[model samples]
Target: MVAFTNFAIAALAGYAAAHPGEKHDAHKMKRELVARDNAAQLGARSLASCSNSASSQALKARSIKRRANAVKNIRQKRGIKAPARKDKRTLEDLQKWEAVNHNMSGTYNYDMFTSIEEVFSGNTSCILAPEITNGPYYVVGEKMRSNVKEALYCDGIDLFLEVQYIDTNTCEPIPAVAVDIWNCNATGTYSGIATEGNYATGGYNSTYLRGIQLTDGDGVVSFETIFPGHYGGRAVHTHLLSHNNAQVMPNGTISVWNSPVSHIGQLFWPEDLRAEVEATYPYNTNTVALTTNDEDMWSILSADASFDPIPQWVYLGDDISDGLFAWIQIGINGSADYTEDEYYGVAAYLDAEGGHSTGYTIGGGGNGTGNGTTPSGTPSGSLSSALPSSSSA
Candidate 1:
């Protein structure tokens, strides 16, 4: 018995020396085994008392998973300071952006829009794409051509404009819609006109950045154009007018700006994108002062707001130099069942259309309403009221 005691004491000392942090010694373990266990039976109570129990780890794991599930449930239901899905996504948010897939640095995306808890109070709705004054730059009865890249001195940035039209009430894609789009060249000059800021194009009258196209079966009108230069008062934007049931003329001309319009609005470049375009080429050399969206008093997406029906823009391309595809969702009130090549008027009939005749050929007075800056080097808050012309195309 004395030898056994001495042996036990020596083992305990060795264990202490090896494991300073361990509170349990060999004697304590032996005592526990002898005091509690019946060699034939192990009780559940004894297992529960163990320090490194599997049950304890499992309990902690379950608790963490439960908390995670609770958080996910709250988010799904939008019960917290999260905006309901209905608040942000209307029936028209089905327009999937298909483009070159540019990396959007500091840009807006669908994820960010839906994640925000508060619905933006501003006028970004599919119900109504805002319409502003056609501005002073619209060329009355401009040619319905695609290649508007005429200005040689213009430092050009390629732009692919995509617009998706949706039925306002049904939120369905409205097919066979005709759209007319126009903007200025890099030097703040417009095509098919002879005016101020147009001196770079020499003495000849020209039209550089203006064209028209009809929507495909998906209710989309895609344009191949260049990034417009900012001029006197307005920020960078594209003006568009849409006509449902509008006819596509044989020569590729669609006369619909004078027709009963289904939708009219503008597409905007993100302010950051603007800074980039302005830094290069003709944009950098433009004499017109730069303008911003806030300064332009252009709050509404207005008019050609496409299928998704908001100011959100998707720029597709790996690099800005390779050009980018920009998209907008527009809403229009029309019939889904209504299928016909809609005619605004015969294009041939408007062959003689010219002279201050009002269609969308605005600008000459430069009243602060444009996709560019005003001539006076000051921000003009908004476009001037479109003066009504008695003449028709």
Candidate 2:
């Protein structure tokens, strides 16, 4: 529903935004991830892939050992020197440091890097991050809001998703890179999809559990959602779309796509967690035949396979009811041209828009009311402007 005032505004007058960068650290971080995390993080796992024989498997084992040793030697050589430290550095610089450590917020163990390699793990050209299809449920004109739960919602375990956008080339965080996320409700029904089978909102137009935010100073964004329900055909997952740049406009929005790097991906939950969430209220109500993680229909989740999209392992609290956190770093090709996938929003707000920025008051410009933990580093604000910047872990 467009407000009358929304129609009156003429093209978001004088609104332009520029993202900060820390491209300098890219080369070193890139080298370290390739030489170290690839072999150690992925090791050897049973994969459903077709390109292996006993001879190839043995050779691969030797290759991994050689790479692992190379990484060990490199680390031993560098151990005499203190780790690189940044002081009074830009937010982008801080993000680069955390990203290189494989810890988005410096809170998690170094395994974050190990988890990242799983996505890029294997003997294939995963140079471009895998792109998943945008299902029919996606709707344009969704409010640029944060709290995605609607009044009419199902019972499900609470899910809090935190994402960091890294520059694939530098393996560094990309401050202000953009991402949008949407997922089904507790009963496996999307908020905006058409009424076909059991989805309640299929006939009604709604935007629950759907929102977009740009990465903050740490190349991070956060969303509060539910552990999604598994639909009949797909695994229990949340959908995410990413871009290198984005801008909001009064008449419309504009997106800058790094097609060679533009990404449409899904994030899945751990099977154990899924079983617990499903046992809860509305999830158990879902009537569709459940597809456990063991099912191989929607891309296998094993680590050793070539890069197709896969679910991320998350960091969470003691109980399933407590919120959960997940992180994934996208590997991208910077020099490659943006082609193939069309930009998500309308294009052409291109660099011609002045770099000078202007801010508008939404809900009368009151500061956000949530605790100081959102991505924007500020307290929560009106639904349209509450994704406050924050650190990642």
TM-score of each: 0.52, 0.51
The sequence of per-residue lDDT tens digits that candidate 2 reaches over residues 162-223 is 55554444434455555767888888876644434534443334567877666675555767
Q: Estimate the TM-score for candidate 1.
A: 0.52
**C-alpha lDDT score of every prediction, in listed order:** 0.43, 0.41
Please give the lDDT score for candidate 2: 0.41
lDDT of 1 by residue, 8-98 (tens): 4444444332111112245653443232223102222222233135543443343334323433443344323422222112223222221
- Per-candidate RMSD, Å: 30.0, 19.8
Candidate 2 differs from the real structure by a C-alpha RMSD in angstroms, to one decimal, of 19.8
Off by over 4 Å in 2: 1-129, 198-204, 250-261, 301-317, 334-393
Residue 260 lDDT in candidate 1: 46
